[model samples]
Target chain A: MDKLQRNERIGILMKLLTDSPGKIFTLGNFTEIIGSAKSTISEDIDIIQDILDKFDLGMIVSIPGASGGIKFIPSISSEKADFITRNLCEELSQKERILPGGFVYMLDIIYNPVKIENIARIFTRQFYKKDVDYVITVETKGIPLAFATARFLNVPLIIVRHYNEATDGASVNINYVSGSKKKLQTMVLSLKSLKRNSKLLFIDDFMKGGGTAKGIMELAKEFECEVSGIGVLIKTAEPDRKLVDNYFSILTLDTVDEENGIINIRSSR
Target chain B: MDKLQRNERIGILMKLLTDSPGKIFTLGNFTEIIGSAKSTISEDIDIIQDILDKFDLGMIVSIPGASGGIKFIPSISSEKADFITRNLCEELSQKERILPGGFVYMLDIIYNPVKIENIARIFTRQFYKKDVDYVITVETKGIPLAFATARFLNVPLIIVRHYNEATDGASVNINYVSGSKKKLQTMVLSLKSLKRNSKLLFIDDFMKGGGTAKGIMELAKEFECEVSGIGVLIKTAEPDRKLVDNYFSILTLDTVDEENGIINIRSSR
Candidate 1:
């Protein structure tokens, strides 16, 4: 087998420590991988840390005492985030995403890496700009975008369920008229969970009637928290009453007519 | 207003380049911001380019003889991502989430930065370990996880769509049974796309019934790529079939009953 070099060691070390949560490493065990001296490994570790710093991807924390080597935190800065959002907005514009009821069929473009990273970065930047403390979304579709935004901002995300369960006690519920359903329904955050005056960003997969977003707004107000902003994967070009104050989208489905073979899309970062 | 600090100046410089795309800037603008000398600004730009590599975010591209001040490419890499995953798994286990119907509410916690960062790191590490060339996911919910995974791996992502459109000329489609629909649904992917023999890690928001996963698996095979592994934000304790080959999950849902206020969560990440 070819002997592992410093660059290889750095790559392996990143692969190993990145998925970890704390700042502790087993140095004795770590140096065994490349079979290199601890001093040599230490120098490699330094250079590796420099590379990580360049990317704005947190840092490598070394533990000094025995049973310690290195760890990682989740971090990123704005300048280092160009490729991500730029790619997302760019690819999203390429889709012929047209569906009925102002819905967009953007499954293809949204999945691309460059776009996803950028979407996450842009949404997070907006959320942070608003100083949102947390992220909120309804079940199923909104989950992915919410997760990405939350990861970028390093904030907690809340998922609201339509139905009530015994496990989640004493919920605050609200209802309003919404798509087909006679009444809109939503559950409030568990009291004392997110603290009063907390700011949150509402995320959804697609926005049409705005009923779900309205319901989330009601839930946020019930918690005595503020709705910092809203974001979505796609928004219909046709205008509708927006429920939240501020929002952005990756793609706008200008129109989609299955029979006419007409689908229009434009990017919105 | 106070003058922008040197670090902030660098950030602003990156922003200008990112927003303008193919544009150049001269030292005069730098002088206006920090009141620094042209040479100082030049050195600052040099330091930025040298220190922050990969961020392909573009470069100083000094044109010695003419038409250039600076240009950027916009890129970044994953380096110090080792210590976040395990911590995320551990924090995820602590959520104590249990809801009926075997649904674990870790999605909320997974969105939480307290552990979400770790989860993202761990996921990225897995991507590198598997040497995945790309990250794959379905739309709506999977976008965020896919984005995070892609961000960590610094790879491209490809999203699969539920339905086909005329815009996607000459495509390949596959049918997989769905748990919610209880019927086979056709998912589409572009043909001759996704470099053949590319390594991919499939990620989703949640997994149950194994049908959706199997469908994703088939989608990858359609592209002539090898499935490196499978990952999910949450997984049902057990399902009738296993959709993934090698899977990793932050939390497992054991039971969920809407009426009994009963939910059980199991963790073995």
Candidate 2:
């Protein structure tokens, strides 16, 4: 058999690890695929390990048991996280995203990758530090951030929709007093989505009257799920009937001056 | 330097080539990481080259000279694409996620790694078959699929939202008739999120009214960005207006039998 180069060897290993997120590979698989000795593969792993460490892309964890081969750890450094957060704030705090009367357009905050990646990483870092089982958010604006957080943590994301439908048999519906619009509205979530006593991290785009957030919280309670953390891309900071605690934000909006063509964005924290 | 495993070395090399996306790496860099002689590393590359071909993930193109190391095709196979489509169908068809209103709760379909990873692979394989600078979707439900797809394609994901706000400027706004309610609603997206003429793959959770989808299509046109492809998890198959041409759906629901609690789903299609 022809010999293999070091660079070529590392490339193959990364693919195997990424393709199977949680699966541990065995040395035998490599031998069969590459037709190389186990010793040669071990040396290749060391080379791949160093390169991964240098780039801060991910980690190659090796298990000693019969079932263990290697797994890649998805990680984000503080520097990268900060870079993403700053970009997100700068980009989302623009004039075009502002709504007709006063609301800010927030979909941009969750969409941009350069920004979302950071939010996802930071949220993941914070979530890992806490005891969160999964990330949860209410649709249709909160999905991006929730998805990112879930991806980073390697956990599932559950969403609560606006109305209760006959399709999902048993759902917990919550009616919250909309402090802003001052009306009662419904929020529904599948009972199976939220596990009992499971830790959850909540995320959304904006917080105004906090009614929706509050409603989602109530939905969590209905499932007996624990709210571990709350993170938002922006907040109105209305200071009344606050929906969440233990939250973080990329930016805060103090006020929106439509007539003056001025919008205030809170300092990044 | 210590010797390394051949397969491990190949993994490291592939990452380096992928780090720069299209850029090729030099043999020197590969040699340095593996700490193996150039000849040994070159031999390892040969084995990896074939493995890549076998897995149908991509190809390792070797470049000769001082500046040349190796390059990855960053391509996917048709088999992977079909696998993804099948997985998406299965995920969306799960019995537990069926909503009472004849809607399939899609939160789980996009959030599950096993499902998201497959969906991502398919997007990269079939739609973004050429160049996709970004994965685009509307807030707030489509975010999960978009994020995963973008992550796999190594591109950014952009979210379009309703209501133009100040935070997202340099954006294009368009009005469209919504499918769910048959009301005209405005959608906004950041111009800066997408580049001119760049290819974008649009994804969404469900297509009932296609109003939001139409609005998104208009927004893409306004931005002068190319709509490379369109995809959805569920297509309701509305009678009159068709919002997207190129798309895929896991399940197609024909009608909702509200009285008998029966839903006619297009499982085979």
Best by lDDT: 2
Whole-model Cα lDDT of every candidate shown, in order: 0.59, 0.67
Q: Per-residue alpha-carbon lDDT of model 2 for A108-170, expressed as tens digits?
A: 455554456556667665556574778888776667667766765667888777676554457
User: Candidate 1, which segments miss by more than 4 Å at Cα?
Assistant: A1-105, A119-129, A139-145, A160-197, A204-209, A222-224, A232-237, A240-269, B1-105, B129-133, B137-144, B156-199, B204-212, B219-226, B232-269
Clash count per candidate = 45, 62
Task: For each candidate in turn, give its C-alpha RMSD to the true structure in angstroms.
Answer: 12.0, 6.1
Best by TM-score: 2
Question: TM-score of chain A for each candidate?
Answer: 0.63, 0.78
How does the DockQ of candidate 2 come out? 0.37
TM-scores of all models? Answer: 0.53, 0.71
